[model samples]
Target chain A: MSRRTTLLTALGWLALAAALLGLAPALLSDFRLGLLAKYCCYAIAAVGIGLAWGRGGMLVLGQGLYFGLGGYAMAMHLKLTDAGPGQVPDFMVLYAGGEMPVWWEPFRSPVVTLLAILLLPVLVATVLGAAIFKRRVKGAYFAILSQALTAAFAILLIGQVKTTGGFNGLNNFQSFFGYSLYDPVNKRMLYFLAAGVLLASVALMAQLHRSRFGELLVATRDAEERVRFLGHDPANVKLVAYVLAAVLASVGGALFVPVVGIISPEDVGVGASIALVAGVALGGRASLFGPALGALLVGYAETSLSESFPGSWSYFQGGLFVVVVLLLPGGLAQALSALASVRHRVGGPPGGRRRRERPASDRTRPGPTTPQEVTA
Target chain B: MSVPGRDYLEVRGIRVEFDGFVAVDGVDLTLLQGQVHFLIGPNGAGKTTLVDALTGLVRATGLASYDNQNLLDRPSHAIVRLGIGRTFQTATVFEELTVLQNLDIAGGVHRRARSLLRRRRGVPERVHETLATIGLTEQADRPAGVLSHGQKQWLEIGMLLVQDARVMLLDEPVAGMSAEERRETGELLHRIGQERTIVVIEHDMDFVRDFADVVTVMSAGRVLAHGTVEEIRADPEVQRVYLGHTVEGVA
Candidate 1:
């Protein structure tokens, strides 16, 4: 990019920061502000999806696993704080009264909760990613494996009525840390925190996208064999992106607990995980701003559509995903590229020509979600 | 780490058997540094398979050694890191990336992961120099995907240059080219071949005759002939199997 384009992009980011940080809080009501905070969490998760599936070419279908780890870690601390010093959570009293599970004890500390929210998801993702990438399992197989793992995670939470809250999961938080939930001022602070984190995540990814590592990530995606012959391990390159994705999802889920006042299996199951992916795909997986904006739009649409037609909301979500996949798999940018041919992207991918050396049959072998060449 | 005129890549008893079909049967070829070695033979004579075996792309039982490390059994990436590189029959530069970015990524194998996370401050001097070497300085900003076929092939060679490859295994580098492009590529091979070991798996007899310092001929998964271009062309045994057609084709 030229110096002039770089200056304009910096200015554009500053303007967006102003709108998101200053303008949004002043404009929306408390309820609406809280909703936006929720959407920001989803956006955080979407950025990770973009890094993994979009650039790294690893379909991270089980981001909910990381999200849940962070959400539950935060919720555990909040629930423990609500229960006082000696007692277990209220759910234990109703379901199977007993001592606090040894595993949940660590999350009682605010420091531990924070660490868990960051490390737990990364740890799990690294283990899972290492196994999958080492075996070179990818495309639809990876997607299915991730989805199945998340489904199993949801099922495990539902079955553990004594420890976890079972089907209801964790909910009814009275406070976040020492801050009272009822205080509107504190609620606004939470919103700013989420928004700020979302911005920082975007900035961090933008930096990575411009970095040598980012270029290598794209190289590995397009030509894994070619990349291997270049002397850099594609598996290791992909693992870094996958780990970053898990960390982002984990952080998003942690913030989600305070902002939404709940952490539940329903929020980190296959449905929720797919919803996060849908938002990214709807936005434009490869574009920097597209994922976050797409997630916000999808979240807003979900709220509006669900309010009007609560029962038909699932059908709408499914239909939206189908349309995005079948018609516009390139996501919102595919539509926008027509209007603003310059469709500005933070991590403007090296667009033009896929693996030309690859047999034509192999490009579409994995199905519609395959990384099609994006020239624009 | 290489001394000119000494053995660089020593391959002994390298055999590739795919379900009872022996593709590369007991091949022993010692590639020496500072030599433009050409491996020329009929199609399916295990030339490509031999390169694959040496590069660790195929699981072959053999002693393929470089820098005292057994090249076989290690991964393809490891083989590259050991100062060995191979290009496919077709150009395989990352089509989406710019020519500069392609070389940058290829060159970065020697850099630390920590350094890679930061934005590239400026084009590295080595990468910049390589653009001139490959004659793609003007096309550096253009995505490699848009380069002309000959240019793409040069970019692939440029990638090996950036990789600092001590041994370069090129597969039919000038298969389709204008006479001018072929000449340019032949010149490129000469420029880079001065310090490194180059093994060109070629079908173009004229290219082999013009460029090869030492030529090895293979037939039916075996070494049919080995020595200078003149010796192989003069031998009656070589004439019967291969050179009978090759000398005619070139004429």
Candidate 2:
């Protein structure tokens, strides 16, 4: 497809999604609308995973650290506001007396809370990415390092009951900006905000993917040593992409707390992080729209299946991931490409012969020794 | 013989050892401005090790400088930024990216932050010019991984061209090319050598004879002979170590 046509098609899809979201209040019940809103948050998280894991090849299995940071930030402000001046939130009252934790004091202001949510993840990711990428660590080693961080973050949160509200997490938020969140209109407005943000994030990702920075990201992914030889620091390139992905995940988490009316340790843990990546992989990591579609699909399946099958929903989710992994290693996007290639092969004229093939020795040689190859 | 006016790169007593194994020991070499120099040796004779040291891929013990700046302490990326570029023995073109995208990224090394942030202009044109020079303009939009091996090698060279580096270090540039492709690559290197210093590591003596202005023969981690190809071919030590019994035919 031509670039112009492809962009126009994407714009049309965005417009259709926005129109549907604008009309959702009239069509669906409040509960279903809320579910869709939650899915938008998941879609936002999936987009971040796509950039970090799919394009940059970082395999960031600990996106939950950023997610929880954002969620907890937003949740703390909501709890403090709901408790009125000076009073402690109910969760804090039961968990650790009727006193607000010192760490939670800064989040008393909504502006400070929101800023913290966004800035904290970017700061953490920058430090983490710089440390890891500068060392030239990559592949499975990088994946494990990220996953370990998520586990550590979750454990720390669970241990700090006085400050973080611990396992129960700060919930029962009554109002947002003097508006009752329980009202159907305000709830729908929040859903619209999430959908808008999801669409805008996708558009931003598309722009980045087309730019020169995006090419460098992919080049680093494919061959960091070669990219270094070309006079571009691969660590800096990967760091930029990594930090962007973390910020996106944090935004998703912040929006998620307000839309779902709840935030908990269970939601931002190792399990949730893995699920986020599975959805992106199932959708097609390299494609622009795949992660959003895949996240929404997974979200819908979780909600609908639990309503019908209850205890078996997790099993179904596990099975679906297995099917995608076994049958479509490239995710759903590859199916389309496979079909196109098959059609071309069948439709080509008869008597078209394969070109002459070169000997094995004529192919390029192996890459230079990497850190891993050297140690091994 | 040393050139009267300029030296694009100079190496003095450079030695590279890995895990106590001397790969290239005390190897001194130099390439004058706009000259094509060749490094040739038998298996494990440290030709690639020398290229690695020059490009900053491997650390060396002694003085290695480019344009009078010490290269031993600089990172690989910094070396490239100092107007030195290299191609791997294996083609290092971004496999999933298009040929044009690869060249555009190559040009990005020298781009300012402001220019990099905006829609990249001038890169497409530079990519086109480089592709055309390498005779791969027709395959500009195709994924580089899908190109023929010789075409991929040329595309990599095109990348080095767009990078606008003053010195090019190629590791076996004609390793996998057909005879015609090798001749075309030889002619292309000759043209490039007119404007930039080129150091090529190769096993093909025929290509070396046709392309090299100066040939340095290495064996057992040291320079065995350094002279014109015919002059080196006639050297008794080079004949004994590198050419062996086959020197009579080439001589």
Question: Candidate 1, residue A282: CA error in Å?
Answer: 1.0
**Each predicted complex: what DockQ?**
0.54, 0.43
Tens digits of per-residue lDDT, candidate 1, B1-251, equal: 34623357898999999999999999999888889999988777899999999998888997988888898999989999999988888899877677888888888988987999887778888899999999999999877777888898899999999999999999989988888998899889999998899999988888888888999988788998899999988877777876454553242
lDDT by residue for model 1 over A221-338, one digit each (tens)?
A: 7788888999987889999999999999999999999899988899999999999998998998876777888899999999999899888878998999888877787788657754
DockQ of 2: 0.43
- On the 0 to 100 scale, the lDDT of residue A115 in model 1 is 91
The lowest-lDDT stretch of 10 consecutive residues in candidate 2 chain A is A367-376
Which docking class does model 1 fall in? medium
Give each model a TM-score: 0.93, 0.91
Give per-residue CA lDDT, model 2, range B175-221, as digits (tens). Answer: 87999999999989888789898989888889998888999988888
Instruction: Score candidate 1 by TM-score against the native.
Output: 0.93
